[model samples]
Target: MNDLPAFLLRKADEYNAPSFIPADPICVPHSFSKKQDIEIAGFFAAIFAWGNRTTIIGKTKELMALMGNSPHNFILHHKEKERERLLGFKHRTFTATDLLWFVQVLQQHYQRYDSLETAFFPTPVKAQEHAVKHGLIRLQQTFFSTPGAPMRTRKHLSSPERNSGCKRLNMFLRWMVRHDNSGVDFGLWKNIAPADLIMPIDLHVARVAKRFGLMERKLPDWQAAEELTAYFRTIDPEDPVRFDFALFGLGVLEKF
Candidate 1:
């Protein structure tokens, strides 16, 4: 495995390009330039990213259209009656009910803060290890903090506290925090360093990590995600999760 780092670097460079965007859910957010729009759009895209890539992109685009393609503005200013446009929307198990709650939470959040980064950090502090873990925990708490928050919607947002890998949320963080000239990841938020970002583990990432001897956990839980991220950090301490492009592309696109 001495050459594994070089192999990963090559693969990461191969896939982390603008060409990688069109067929993936990341395209949903790439369609927008506003920071909040990207955050809101990317959040939905990541959350809806299951089953099939085409379906995920389609559903996310439909959601954005329902919001009149100005997600941040729509979430902040749309009337209660305007929400009816989202009535029949459904992506896999995510229903209109879930979307409404999401809108409510986002509206409440954006009303107070200009960006979604604060929802994760809530305060300015120097970058620290385990920042993403704490941020995920805090986000789950704040998401469900509203009075009478639906129990059904809780399934949509996973937390490390629940032993979930929080794949979708971690993926969203990757979209928001990973900075590069590659133009794939947005790098819109600076509070969390890319180094501290945990690997967003799904079946694809898990399979690739195991094949490359990066992880051993049988279950792809939060521990497995952390284990894989820890391994990558050994190779590139400052920007470990950049290897995600390699692992995910190998598993999903190359079927390795």
Candidate 2:
């Protein structure tokens, strides 16, 4: 409070964070095999991915199909029944091949298991690390998911390809974590904290954040997210990500 910028300090009073907004995307077939499967299906949807919306839309739909929803049922029919249907190969469309690859790997790695939380994280390092250790990278065409490695946060994007991957994961996390109705709640990440989370910064929001004096560092990378998240931490240490909507909307809406 003592050193915060005048503008950011105001958001504490300006925004009313939604109590919840459909963390439907994070549920995986493993942890999601039981309850709230719609959320898991939604978690698979590519909603809120960072990139051109056009590209993301198709990918989202494809992911939906892979999650066992009917490819023809654009209305998300399975959203109600929460059935365990799989997309027959002949009916496939709209999904990213990479995502399908990951899903397949998930099926391979956790075939006997369930629960993205127990099957994935709460370890010493982030989930990406365990993915690598389990040879998920071998599952990849090139870059493998490695344990104890840097994550694909907003700042870590090195190239357009990496940037795309970052968007995919971010979109996935958004649907899975914060979003509510999209699927079943794995509840794996529930006890985990936001300070433990990283910001998914994009150029537009980075620029806006800077203009608003939210962050001033020139080079956008892991450091920038750290700094920005740190400042937000000042507002709500337990859930700095709660400010994500306000910050992202500030940029997207071009609000000064």
What's the lDDT for all of these models? 0.91, 0.43
Error of 2 at 197 (Å): 1.5
Please report the candidate that would top lDDT against the real structure: 1
Clashes of each: 0, 33
Please estimate how well model 2 matches the true structure, expressed as its whole-model Cα lDDT.
Answer: 0.43
For model 1, what is the C-alpha lDDT against the true structure?
0.91
Candidate 1, residue 181: lDDT: 91
Candidate 2 per-residue C-alpha lDDT over 120-149 given as tens digits, one digit per residue, 9 for 90 to 100: 233433433123223212223222353432
What TM-score goes with each of the models? 0.97, 0.56
Cα lDDT, model 1, residue 76: 97
Q: Model 2: residues >4 Å from true position, as ranges?
A: 1-43, 46-48, 54-58, 70-97, 123-188
Model 1 C-alpha RMSD vs. true structure (Å) is 1.0
